[model samples]
Target: MPRIVSAFLCAAFIALGVTACAEPAHQKHAPQDPPDYKGVPTDMTPPSMLTPSAKPQ
Candidate 1:
């Protein structure tokens, strides 16, 4: 009967779904070591003070 076929198909789909959800989840691996941070130094001198005419004669 059509009802029997429908019930079998539904059961098959439910089993497939359960099997798919039962698999272990993937995990990300951690890095071996952290990278070193080098700090950047800023220039404190004024732009106008670096010009040739701005220097002492």
Candidate 2:
């Protein structure tokens, strides 16, 4: 039983090592400036497009 447990642990560790080594290297994305929002519109919908919801009696 002890040997079986040890074998399973060793297999699991080897599997983990193999998977770790198979992954792609970490990539560094180029730094980018955030988009300017100084002139953007804040209101998505105007008051003219609003409608009252019908209520059940």
Best by lDDT: 2
- For candidate 2, the lDDT comes to 0.85
* Residue pairs in collision within model 1: none
- Clashing residue pairs for model 2: none
TM-score of each: 0.41, 0.41
Give per-residue CA lDDT, model 1, range 1-57, as digits (tens).
999999999999999999898966765785454466455457878877786665575
Worst 10 residues of 1 by lDDT: 31-40
Error of 2 at 34 (Å): 16
Clashes of each: 0, 0
The TM-score, computed over Cα atoms with residue i paired to residue i, of candidate 1 is: 0.41
Off by over 4 Å in 1: 24-57
Please report, in order, the local distance difference test score of every candidate based on alpha carbons: 0.79, 0.85
